[model samples]
Target: MHGPHVVVVMGVAGTGKTTVGPLVAEALGVPYAEGDAFHPPRNIAKMTAGHPLDDEDRWPWLDAIGRWAHERAGYGGVVSCSALKRAYRDRLRAAAPGVVFLHLTGDRELIGERMSQRKGHFMPETLLDSQFATLQPLAEDERGVAVDVSGSPHEIAERAVAALRAA
Candidate 1:
């Protein structure tokens, strides 16, 4: 059986997954999984140079992230991923049958602005549009909660924890 709940903090590049995932993990008493660490260098370079990753470039990374999510399900953990598309989310589900996603959503332009101001990130602001195009918002059947990114980081983190606790 899966542990209490595994929060997968998911969104586009600047949607606060990195910022929020650990906060939620701390609140829930679980380890934090950095999904970006699982990405291949090639993909990282492609995004670093302002090129968007296609489906082929993403599948294996998705698989790795999913496995990472499932690997510690016995104890519970939080994973941050740019799980933009439904197929990506599907692979995550296959790896961990009961993973719960906390989607951090915001306007593409706003996110791009954040990405531009950010430092040390490989994913450039130019790829923000592609990420938005690829996104498939959580469906009603998915075990997830949608948190708007228009608020403060703590607000978003609290909202995710509240949803998980309530669930």
Candidate 2:
């Protein structure tokens, strides 16, 4: 928190990473990027058809986000990425060594309900299980914090900010 840091707001679908990421960035006076926007049309189409993305399907998207994080290295920025695996996070860190993660954690039931309520999102509730299955929580060595996603977006963002500051 002493200097500029790129924070990746990461979680499974429906975790509100998109909503909370910008708020976190604003609170820290930084820019925000939507992870979904980096995905190619084919990737979006696959997900929209209810197929989960494989590692190969995600590499380019991850790389794009990583590049964005690398560009914001000296100037802080926030971005929403699923970052479900440690390898994905590693790829990001390789691009931007100072990148930190803000992982949103929540129960499947709550997240599924949220996903179902959301409109126009490519990701479907059917893929929630695959998301959770692929998720690997941050390791002790990782520079990140996991926040419970059981509150208002403002409250969640506040918690993320406090935790990131503490980190």
Candidate 3:
């Protein structure tokens, strides 16, 4: 079993990064960090306005997030983020080469429905399409595992942990 030896929970919002991450973190007995909270207020404002962030807007934040994920291996923690692009993932890899990604994949309609029901978040349901548009699905060689989100949160978390152990 590969302890990661560090990990990141990744997916578009409503795919359950926040919910799945904490459970996975607890199972591994490691600290958990939420990636959303690291976003710049300007970026939050843009997303709140129902606008998609371009790579220009994302690089700095992505770098910051990647560096933070890199640190988790030494400090011992798990991070949850959308991490929607391959280039972004590469930057993350540069920072933390051994970082394992636990990808949460769910149906577009289901994720949209959940996002629509959510409240108090900067990202809106309207942005779901944009997120999916920007999403670059991970390849098998990316050093991670994909967990289908058709089941319960606990099921997702269990599958993630199981994959992590096997990775």
Q: Against the true structure, whose lDDT is highest?
A: 2
Model 2's alpha-carbon lDDT is: 0.96
Q: Write one digit per residue (lDDT tens) for candidate 3, span 93-151.
A: 88887788888998999898888888788888888888888899888679788889888
User: 15-106 in candidate 1: lDDT tens per residue?
Assistant: 99999899999988899988889999998998888899888998999899888777877778899998888888988899988799898989
Better of 1 and 2 by lDDT: 2
Question: Candidate 2, residues 103-135: lDDT per residue as tens digits?
Answer: 999999999999999998889999999999999
- Descending-TM-score candidate ranking: 2, 3, 1
C-alpha RMSD in Å of predicted model 1 compared with the true structure: 1.8
lDDT of each: 0.85, 0.96, 0.84
> Positional deviation of 124 in candidate 1, in angstroms?
0.7
User: Sort by lDDT, best first: what order?
Assistant: 2, 1, 3
C-alpha lDDT of residue 140 in model 2: 99
Once fitted onto the true fold, the runs of candidate 2 whose alpha carbons sit more than 4 angstroms away are none
Clashing pairs in 2: none
Q: In model 1, which runs have C-alpha deviations exceeding 4 angstroms?
A: 1-3
lDDT of 1: 0.85
